[model samples]
Target: MMWKTVLITIFAAGVLADDFSQITAVVTSQCTKNNAEDKVPEVEAALRTFGNCLKGLVDLNVLKTEIEEAKPNGALDEVFKKYCDKSAQLKGCISSVLQGVRPCVGNEYANHINDAQNSTNQLIDFVCYKDGDRIALFIAEGGPECFQQKTENLKTCFLNLKQSFPTVESANNLSLVEKCAKVDEMTSCIVKSLEECSTPTPANMAESLIKFMRKDSPCHTALPVSIV
Candidate 1:
């Protein structure tokens, strides 16, 4: 989930950096500055533990190779399931880290961090828990085209959306309603890409993406019932 957040942040702004290192620096800096210097080592260690846990579960190079070598027509349900089974442990690790840092950083920072993590967790739940088989099948059938060919377009769409605002900071500060408006455009763009790529754009897939945006977001009531 931390990786998801870091990747999204990078893709949204169209910048790349060492994600774990950036996260550790940001968190450790917070602790050191807020009259919590003594807690710095503890917080740093906890963050490293969580990061190591994630790295153990997800090897980017291996995952990429597996996905690339996966036969389009072959069964990949089991392959994805193997990773999904570790979700519980991943969640537990993050939960513990969050709890350990809360007292040092206070509620505001902890809650902000939690919200970001929750967004990634929601995505995992959607892909692996709520509708695992359907999602796995979608990947098996359309993954190559979407990931290999259209990934740039997807990234471009987000970067463009981010550019529409005055500044990156301003974009990040947008109200939930304003953000959901942009999300609507993003959803349409994605659906269009899927159609152009000859990938199946199931109604539920679009619906789920919208619903996922609404979850834990202040835009729950502002977003439409259907957009696809």
Candidate 2:
């Protein structure tokens, strides 16, 4: 009778071990770079946490002979089923995040990046109010056409602070104006991305500010960006 209980317990534990091992491999197989190298140690750490949490019910050694004699029940089966179910879910979320580096996924991220760039440029126009060859703070707002021409080779950011800094800062507001013009543009881009995900609209260019994060959008799978 004791041998019968031991056999059942060993069988159950073996099945559980096999399922858990497969889940570990499924997670480790992802997150690689060009040479098939794992991205980082951090990825392993995260996978361990996920695997451990899922298999926390796995230790059956505590069951004595009488407890095991009852034979396999639905409860034991449910534990293995939960692992397969949750591993699938974790796989999907990881795939989505990794898509960011993929060509298709990169393109998707780029769309947001491009939208972010356009939105940033608009804020530059609103703030710099560049007109003709002359730039002044008090001038009227320019349309998209203001960005049509480059102040330098930089079409998106109106002024390059890297080159603009000079005798201007110690000299007067002109330097300050030049410095702020570029910095403010970066701020606009960040804010616009948040908006696009939340409040996107076709009627409004400012709607870039209301961006909707469409992971399943055709943009993610069809264009230059996609997950592997």
TM-score of each: 0.67, 0.19
lDDT of 1 at 59: 78
The TM-score that candidate 1 achieves is: 0.67
Query: lDDT tens digits, residues 131-163, model 2?
Result: 311111111123223333322334333233334
| Segments in model 1 whose C-alpha atoms lie over 4 Å from true places | 1-40, 58-73, 97-109, 165-175, 201-207, 213-216
After superposing candidate 2 on the true structure, give the runs of residues whose Cα lies further than 4 Å from its correct spot: 1-38, 60-67, 72-228
RMSD to the true structure for each prediction, in A, is 5.3, 25.4
Task: Give each model's whole-structure lDDT.
Answer: 0.62, 0.33
TM-score of model 2 vs. true structure: 0.19
Which digits, one per residue and each the tens of the lDDT, describe model 1 over residues 80-140?
Answer: 7777888888677666666556545554455566776676577677778633675666676
Clash pairs, model 1 backbone:
none
